[model samples]
Target: MNAFSLRRVGLALLAPAIAVVVSVIVTTIVIAAVGSSPGDFWSAMFSNPLPRIRVNVVNQTAMIYTSAVAAAIGFRMGLFNIGLEGQYLMASFAAASFAGAAYVGGFLNVGLSLLIAIAVGAAWAGIAGILRTTRGVSEVISTIMLNAIALTLVGYLVDRYGVHEGNTVRTTKIAAGDMVKGFTPYQARDGQVWALAIIAVLVGVGFWVLLNKTRFGFDLRASGQSESAALASGVNPKRMILVSMMLSGGVAGLIWMPALFGSAGSYGTSFQFGLGFLGIAVALLGRNSPIGMLFGAVLFAYLSAQSNTLTFSTDISPSIVQITQGVAVLAVVISYEVVRRWRARLEQRVVSRELAGAMGATA
Candidate 1:
């Protein structure tokens, strides 16, 4: 890679690391304030029936990574997808509904249902994309509004067509064969691994290729960087914008696969919350890079998993986890800006030195 590319990668890595360190520091302070020993908290966080802890880690990792990927896809195209939670809910409900309607093989049926969920999510997101492209609406506003619409629409669907006989809000449980498994290679109470977790990593790799190696990816980036320039250069900026939003929504749908297919077995009103906003934070921490996003997701997962253990072993409230997450995101944002400025100054210096050398040779 060129120096510029390497620098970008470095910044991406640095942002998440800075966030993690800041979160640790903030968490330590909170522990002290709560009259808990930070050392004990740390011990509880790390020492465990390693397999069980790993399972929780894998679950959170999968969820966060899927959400992060959804946000990153939109961020790359200069669109903010704030409807991931609703999209996830809708897709999960669709998947569960399909699974409940028919019994099939373990992997085959689940795979097909997931495919349908992705398509549904894409279509849902495409609505906002179309609005922005044809009606000149802001995607930020459109997506936010669409989130509410999706929640209401999916809630009604679950109640009317998908819910179990006795349940007031939740859909029916997906069959055993339809749940995602083998996500972490660790044994759990359910004996199921989050197959979606493995899928999330593959999706991350696919995203890397999509954003950096493909012509479509180039067009998306160009439009994000400069819409008018991309339009002048023969790119269909409107189409790209619409397509990017759909892709973002599709990724969001993946987040729900684990919840719907792996454990929850159903969709409910309470099932759709916080994930969309968390996705925005993950995207910022990842700086729109797929690999970086994976790391950020893993870190967030670790923190989240640790929080529960910490609560059990100490006087610290579970709310401390939220505080840490918020501080981490804020720290990462500020650090990213600072690092970007520094890199820009370094590039300027390099260019200035080259120009001086050229002038001296001319003289």
Candidate 2:
């Protein structure tokens, strides 16, 4: 990479670095005030969150990474598609219902089920997109309302047709043979490794390539950076909005797959929630870079996994993690502005140096 690219990368890392340092300092003070040995707590976490990073952490990171990428798609386009919660849940419900109701068998069944999920998620988000493009409604409002509708629908259907054994409620399990194969090598104490981990990695790579290497991605980003400039460049803002929203939701459909295919084999009342919103935080922390999001998701998963150990061993509250997360995000937001100005100065210096060199050569 050139100096500008290297500097840009540094700018990207600066905010998260500052946020981590600030969060640690604040969290330590809070722990000390709470009558806990802040030094001991920090030592325990930094020494080892686990004997080693567990498979569960890896799986959770992958899931979160997918969620972050879904949100990043919208971020890149300057559209906040807050309806990821609705899109993924509806997709999971549709996937579970279709997979259980069908008699199809094997990997083919799994593939089809996943396709159903992507389509359902995209279609749900499409509603919001259509409204935004045609009626100029704010996506934030439409998506929030859609989340309520999606949840209500899921609740009703699960109650009506979901398998209810005793008091527990879950979707009917697919055939045992149909479960996606797990990576036994990476299995933690839980012995459940999400086979879809490969899929998550692919998604990250694809996301990076799409945004950096494709024309549509360029148009989407252009519209995001400046709608007026994009319009002057002959880009259609309406189409960008619609396409980016659908793309965001389509990727979001896969967020639940790791949990569903890797563990549940079906959707249930007990399925994981709030990841969609968590993804927004991840996207912000990572500044929408796929690699950056990977590290951000892993850091989040690590902190969360470590919190359980902290709760058991220290007087400090586990809810401290929430405070840390909030503070870290706030720190990053503030630090980003500082880094932005720093980068602009660096770029100006480089331009001035190059201009001086050209003048000297001519003289």
Candidate 3:
């Protein structure tokens, strides 16, 4: 790799490390300030029930990593896909709806249905991309609005077609035969290894390749770095924008698959939309690098799971998890700025030395 590429990788790795260290220090201070014993809190966070804790960790890790990858894809293309929540919700509903439809059948049939669900999600996101490219609408605004619309639409669908055979606002349980197989071990119980984790890792690797090794990836990065320059270089900014949004939505759809096809079983009005928002934080913490995003997702998941265990074992409130996430994001953002400035200085010094050496040789 070139020096620039190596430097970028080094800086990407550094951001998360600095962020984690700062978050830990800040969290400890917050714990003491809140009149909690830091030692006790730390212990509770670390030591917990073996089996249940493992399950929690695995579930949280899977969920966060899925969501983080969704957001990271958009971040790489210079699009902030804040509508991941909406896309995820829509995909989940689509998956559940297809599974419940009597016309749907065999295992291969079920796989095709999931592809349809992912396509639906991509189409929904593509709408925002269209607006942004064609009408000059800001993706941030359009996506946020789309999220509200998606929630309401899904809510209505649940009310109209829910399987409860009553007034409840939730979908019917997906047919067992149609569900994605081997994604979660929780099917038979609360905790076990399933194919979902492996799938998630593979997806992450796939994205890493797409972002780092492909021509499309290069165009996307160019568009992100400078629209004018990308346009000058023969990259179609509008097409890149639209494709990025669609890919991002597809990733979000994958996140929904685990919950809908996995043991979670059904969609409900109680289903929340924070995963998309959390994904933005994850992208920021990861500095939008695929590898960094994976690590960031794991750390965020670990803290979330730790919070659940801490809630039952100690007096600490679960709200601390949110605080920790916020702190981590803040630290990473600041660290990125710091690292950027340092890199600039280093580059300037190198240039100056090269110039000086040239002058000496000429003299």
Candidate 1 pairs with clashing backbones: 182-193, 183-193, 183-194
Residue 264, candidate 3: C-alpha displacement in angstroms: 1.8
Best by lDDT: 2
TM-score of 3: 0.88
How many clashing pairs in candidate 2? 0
TM-score of the candidate numbered 1?
0.86
**After best superposition, candidate 1 residue 155: deviation in angstroms?**
2.6
lDDT of 1 by residue, 245-356 (tens): 9998888887867767666777665464677788788788778778667777877777777777765677667677778778888998888888788878978887898899
- Residue range 221-329, candidate 2, lDDT tens digits: 8999999999999999998999899999998988988777776888886589988887888888888988889988988887777777776777777788877877777
Of 1 and 2, the candidate ahead on lDDT is: 2
Clashing residue pairs, backbone N/CA/C < 3 A, model 2:
none
Best by TM-score: 2
Reference-based lDDT, residue 353, model 1: 88
Per-model lDDT:
0.78, 0.85, 0.78
Superposition error at 14 for model 1 (Å):
5.6
316 Cα displacement, candidate 2 (Å): 2.6
Q: How many residue pairs clash in each candidate at the backbone level?
A: 3, 0, 0
